[model samples]
Target: MDINLSLRHLRAFVAVADCGGYSAASRQVNLAQSALSRTIKEIEDELAVSLFDRTTRRVSLTAAGEQLLLNAREAIASFDGAFLRFQHYREGLSGTVSLAALSSVASILLPPVIFEFQSLRPNVRVSLEDGFAGEVVDSVMQGRVDFGITSLPRKKGRLICEKIAADTLTCICSSRHRFASKRSIEWRDIEGEDFVSFALSSSIFEVVEQGLRSADVSLGNITKARDIGTVAGLVSSDLGISVVPSLVLPMMQFCEYRGMPLSNPVVERNIYLIYDPETPMPPASTFLMDLLRRGPRSKFKIPNGVRWIDYPDGSCQANSN
Candidate 1:
């Protein structure tokens, strides 16, 4: 018997078997009734065996037909499953996306994006690493990850950087502290006070120190912490007050800590999405990047004492309220 059977032949045979007759199978296969019958005849001829017992009153499967029916269904299903997987791959819905992100962005901002992304592409695997801003940048530069979420890269080099959010630096203090009741304070207000801030290696601390320098306000007594979580704990314990990004408020250990807007030299750190333009991203990574770009700033609930400082381009404003 000739094994030269096509998918159309297998499909027509399955259609007739399931539909119980050629007339009904024609409609199911979207082929003419006569064409459908001819397809089944060709498949039977290829196998050199009868596949169905047909009569004027009814059509049913014979012993040979029953065996072929099972094999045919299994073959069609396997082909379709492979085709669907390939289609998903071509559409960029079934690959892995690797990302490196700063600790703050990873904890505060990425969970919603990751949740929504997983719901959309359940087959695509997502991997993320949380590190300092410098580490995140290095991962992108070294091709260790697909892209990174961190403070804007200090030097563009070969990377493309786009701002995702502008997080303002605010003073955090124990509720009982003198500055907590104030609506806003300036760099000068915290001068001469004990300061708990980012470690000297932190990019944010560099920004804060530069801002303080421009304002000519100095804190002689200072302690440094590596992450926002530790900085918040220090403020909560009254060990020392600290300045941190507004996103840290949601993760603070103590509800009694107050966030006060710092002015005179308002410091806003722009969070950026950085990728190597020379390296093409996987389809899954591109899809997730689009989702992150389209996320509305209003979705991030701005806590009290934090105001939306509008930029001239309106890109930094979170919401009107």
Candidate 2:
């Protein structure tokens, strides 16, 4: 026999069995008595088994009906439970959000936001991956993560980059350095100074280099480090000074250093939230994205030398060029 059953058939059969008659089952199922009878008959025909014993006073389930009743109830419960879980996911009450960000952003910018998000939706899990700017972009592009937070990408390609915050480059040096006494130092002031430079792979390096180029100033490159901690360690050792985004200052708090806001061509590093427009973000991911887009001015505290950029409609694309 070719058996094909719809939920309607199973539900009608269960109602008839539970209510013990067509008249009462019709009321429970909101179907006319005649229609309810046809639905039960349809199930029986499909399964090639008589499911009910009809009596003038009462209708009772047969052996086949009794066995199916157990499975049918379990099936309906499982289906409904699945839908309820999906509802929770759609409402951002539960599910996981995977995010990738630059090391500085992951450490300095995301902690409070993640805390607030978890407080609001405790069941929602947030997984964060911290890496260099290029790795952050790659995670978003390869679909390994839901979104990325980083400085503007050199080649944005298909990524939709939205500027979320801006941090001015600050010159960091040992506390005992001569520039520590100055309120603020210009780019030219660091000329001929021993500089601990970031590796070429670092986005900060590019911004600082461009800023130096714009100011027509040069520094004696003492060392190149790939990690921010290494850079901080080197600068703290008084080997040389370094120019880093102000957002990174928080990470260097353990090291003894004085950060002077760089001027004479203030270079601002624009941080962006990037994602592939082709992929649809989940509700949890969308919720977190909205929180980040609101920036520090809304509810989060803005760090020194860093300012939030508010987009008129809550978002705007970066100028990839």
Please report the candidate that would top TM-score against the real structure: 2
lDDT of 1 by residue, 9-89 (tens): 989888888988988889988999988888888877878899899999668998999998898899999999999988897
Best by lDDT: 2
* Prediction 2 global C-alpha lDDT: 0.89
Please give the CA lDDT of all the candidate structures: 0.80, 0.89
In model 2, pairs of residues that clash are: none
Q: For residues 1-321, write the lDDT of model 2, one tens digit per residue.
A: 456988788889889999999999999999999999889888888888899899999988899999999989988888889999999999999999999999988988888889888998999999999998999988998999999999888877789888888899999999889988988999999989999999999989999989999999878856999988899999999999999999999988888998888998899998898998889898999998888877755677758888888854435665465
